[model samples]
Target chain A: MVRPGGRSARVQASVHAAVRELEAEVGREALTVPLVATRAGVTPSTIYRRWGDLQELLSDVAVERLRPETAPEDKGSLRSDLEAWAEQFLEEMSAPTGRAYIRDALLGGPDGTNAGQCSAYAAEQIDVILDRAADREENAPDVETVLDRVVAPMMYRILFRPEGLDTAYARQLAVGLVGSNDR
Target chain B: MVRPGGRSARVQASVHAAVRELEAEVGREALTVPLVATRAGVTPSTIYRRWGDLQELLSDVAVERLRPETAPEDKGSLRSDLEAWAEQFLEEMSAPTGRAYIRDALLGGPDGTNAGQCSAYAAEQIDVILDRAADREENAPDVETVLDRVVAPMMYRILFRPEGLDTAYARQLAVGLVGSNDR
Candidate 1:
């Protein structure tokens, strides 16, 4: 079965299972190849052959978590679209696992390149929100600035602190960011 | 000299020298107390006697780097104050060592507490701009949003990339962020 071929379905399944187990036990730090192999009952060489290193494996895993569910589908108006976007960001801030993954990505260790991936994800999300305000081209800068300053900080405060994401704060951010008129 | 006594000037100098050398050589990862002591030509006992551990030593070094320069005496208007802030931020982004130190402080290590120190530094810098805006509190939130989205990213791009700090981009960010006010 091991004739210099790609990983078998069974092997892939085992590796996926091992990654979850390792993450649960020691978080991102323990996602090393040797650890994953040991947990999966596979040799280190098998992992190395399938995925070059832990980063490649972790990148794949991290990408899987990048769901676009938060990007509003057609909120009818620019204001509502922005509110939805801010709400999604707040949801991410409230979830411990979401915060942990972000911190891990930013920490830039064995998986430092993950920062770029995460940044790209954020940029894309921002693009979607900005798209709604494009017809009112004068509002582009204001929309972008609000998203970064007000909306973004709400996520950041909760991410860095032990406190839960505050709904009132999120509401304040959305309204202030998407003010009644153009900048 | 190594006995239990009050801290001395010579010991402080050695610690600073050790920190500078440690950061120059291996960034922040290899900044252990033993490593600092060996490089400083001081015994580990002497080093340990001075600072509790790597974190304590690093935090002190960070504080020294964060001492604020005097803000412009009077930049004429709020726009000028913001433009000056962007220029100052750009200057720090221009230095390779400064950029690396800030990144490490912000992203932090495997433990994740270092980022907090970095955030505090950023908050202080942001406060300076905020206080300046408070001088004319009409559009403080708007000013802050611009700083967060535009000025901050320009610094990050310039510092972390091969392009170095972009003076033109800084100017654009400052101007765009605080457009020709209704004045």
Candidate 2:
């Protein structure tokens, strides 16, 4: 039996596929709703109704691409787990394409739901790390603190200054948080 | 001397004044570039050329308005100063109008220069607090740490999950940083 959003998922898949193909062919600058819709076998109105506009559609696709497909790596300790997770987070988010995706995620209009979804992904990873710490009886900071201390700074640097983001910087934040919190 | 950007400054002032007046009268939805140009006594081309378009003009003005006009209030100690600054920052950034301005500021096209300017304002305030701490010989987190620990979290909360942002929460971040860093 098909799930509730099966048809919708198919449409989204086709649309995303169309975008990738067109991007590779003519590039992002020359893309439009009609062209993408034609390639995806959906009407232009459908694209507009669902995604609001071409830019939002592109942002939706990019944000979806950014969704983590697998759990963060297990590094045996809370500190190492956080460091590894944060390093991957910074690497993916600090690249040029990643930066564009981050920017577009926030620009999801007044509701700003896309940015919230992105934050939730980070929070989930932190929770996993915290759970590992719990199992090991190791001290740990709360997920909120991890978000505030590690993830926020990386994202802040990515969006604004956008320089000097590296594994060392990411590891520093994790180590500092772990040190202060005894986690 | 008139200064290099004299005419540009006047145009910006008149345009800003026009936006405020029109926002109060006709409301934001009804605003158009030609209408603002006529009101500000400049040609539409001037507004378009300088600001790119109506949305860009509106964003430029909002970012300009968001710029800090004065130095952060000094409270003698680094902890108090950071707490005060962070609380004020969260309050301003989480407010409805402030949120809109921030969104627009980042939406300032590909360069994202407005976001950079906003970061500079916070960094400058942080520097002042650090300098004060230095004078008092109080151990203090560096400017980057302050940006990471306090300001980044506040901004992340503001942009993503905007609820539950308040003075107490802001104070907690500042106080926690000080406790950790011996400042």
The global C-alpha lDDT for each of the candidates, from Candidate 1 onward, is 0.60, 0.85
Model 1, span B4-72: residue lDDT tens: 343566677777788887787797776788888888778888866766667666755664575556644
How high is each candidate's interface RMSD, in Å?
A: 5.2, 1.0
> lDDT tens string, model 2, B36-136?
99999999999988889887888788877888888888887777888888888888888888888888778786787878888988898889888888998
The DockQ score of candidate 2 comes to 0.72
lDDT of 2 by residue, A113-140 (tens): 7888888888888898899899998989
Q: Could you report the DockQ of all the candidates, in the order they appear?
A: 0.21, 0.72
lDDT of 1 at A151: 43
Clash-forming residue pairs, model 1? none
Model 2 docking tier (incorrect/acceptable/medium/high): medium
